[model samples]
Target: MANKRTPAASENDRLYGRALAVIRMRQGIPQQRAAERLGVTTQAWQNYEAGLRKSIFTVDGLSRLATALDVDPGLIEQVKGLLKEGVSEAWMSDGAQPLPTSGSEGKVVFFSRRAEPEVPPAEELAPVYGAVFAGKPGAIAFTPDRPDDWKPVHPNQRGYRDPFYLQVHGDSLSPRFEPGELAPAVRGVWPTRGQVCIIETHDGAMLLKYYERRDAQSVWVRELQPEPREFGVHLADIRAVHAVVGGAVS
Candidate 1:
């Protein structure tokens, strides 16, 4: 027997089709032209736009579609709202079962169908630390003193947790970053390759650069400025590492 489509999946298909139609119309591109740009047959594209067919665009396909439509690929995810709405409606219509909040084993299981609890506003401010360099060591040490001189940033504004800010100085990371910019770093979050991060050396020095890779003995980094420069430091010399959430020009 064939499986049936769930309400959430059906809603997703409908929303995707509608959004695709709207984007195509807004771009003033005819169905045939849009289909050709997407490298699909006219009938297949029409069926997709009419919600008769499901969308199966891969990562590269989505990028191509976004390029042809002149829109960001992330915009396609907006259809998720339709799935959420469908789930809510299904829970209401199908009489959702509520499991016990606490089980005999002293455990708790929360159902997704239930309304989400209210989240309090994040009002706490994160402190900005002293400047971290992108070059060789300076005479100054990495100090957390003088909280009065630091900038206080709201964590909710950037979706960060236990965030601390740092000032950027030197030209090694120029073009992408400039001196006097406030870089927000989230504690305890490990950064992947190509992400900007704050690196603290055991000798009490701090640096900010793009994280390249790390091995058992050393951490490699890159600086994109006048040109790309790569370097590595022994793990023994490193104190701590934090991912740079974002930054603002001061």
Candidate 2:
């Protein structure tokens, strides 16, 4: 059984709670959803965040949390050290830690410090945003929080100024793009004819379409799934267009 968190440990709990809050926020996961993922009640999750729950310090709790947050379980030790020793360089390397793999159902493979590698440069990493729709008009608001996951920058994406990745959520661009595929996209690079593009409109909406053609009045695009169709967004209303490079490699 896990030990109860005592009032004397309140400071440590508060500090740990803050770390949990940061990870949860970056993934854009709601408290309710996190609770569901961890097999706990929403109020339990809230208590965990308030430093009132010590159950999370147990082995099972840590495993569930690593899976729930979609981060490495090794991170728990880093966080534990933070609580016991105060601040250090843990946060600096937190973003690039590789995700944990499942050893079996409900079990996460933990890595030892001896097996870890030096932290790579931030530029070599690409932030993987949560699901983005491919067929419909939606909005993707960039948050100050870190992304849900990170991947090594793709070879083809190396030349771009700021390259990132997002998981496809819809199939409007089907065959060419299947749902759940992670695609690399880069800013400043304009999409050419027939290329897949991520477009942001002035109204703050985003769209994924094939670049068809553009004129002074409108920028046209094509969609494949459901039915083949073409549409145009007013040139003045278009905010930015990013090219989704070749699919994520390795």
Candidate closest to the true structure, highest lDDT: 2
- Clash statistics: count for each candidate: 0, 1
Candidate 1 has what TM-score?
A: 0.48
Give the poorly placed runs of model 2, Cα more than 4 Å off. 1-123, 139-146, 248-250
The number of the candidate with the highest TM-score is 1
Q: Write the per-residue lDDT of candidate 2 for residues 1-250, one digit (tens) a residue.
A: 9997556447767766666765666445689998998789999888887777886866777666756765445555555544454443343234332222233353443333345334546658988865557665654443315588888876556534577777777788887778778777876455545667777677666677887655446778899989999998886888777777665333
TM-scores, all models, native as reference: 0.48, 0.47
Candidate 2 root-mean-square deviation in Å? 16.8
Q: Cα lDDT for residue 65, model 1?
A: 61
After superposition, candidate 1 runs with Cα above 4 Å error: 1-123, 148-160
Give the alpha-carbon lDDT of every model: 0.59, 0.64
Error of 1 at 47 (Å): 40
lDDT of 1 by residue, 22-64 (tens): 5555445688987887788999787776566654555665556
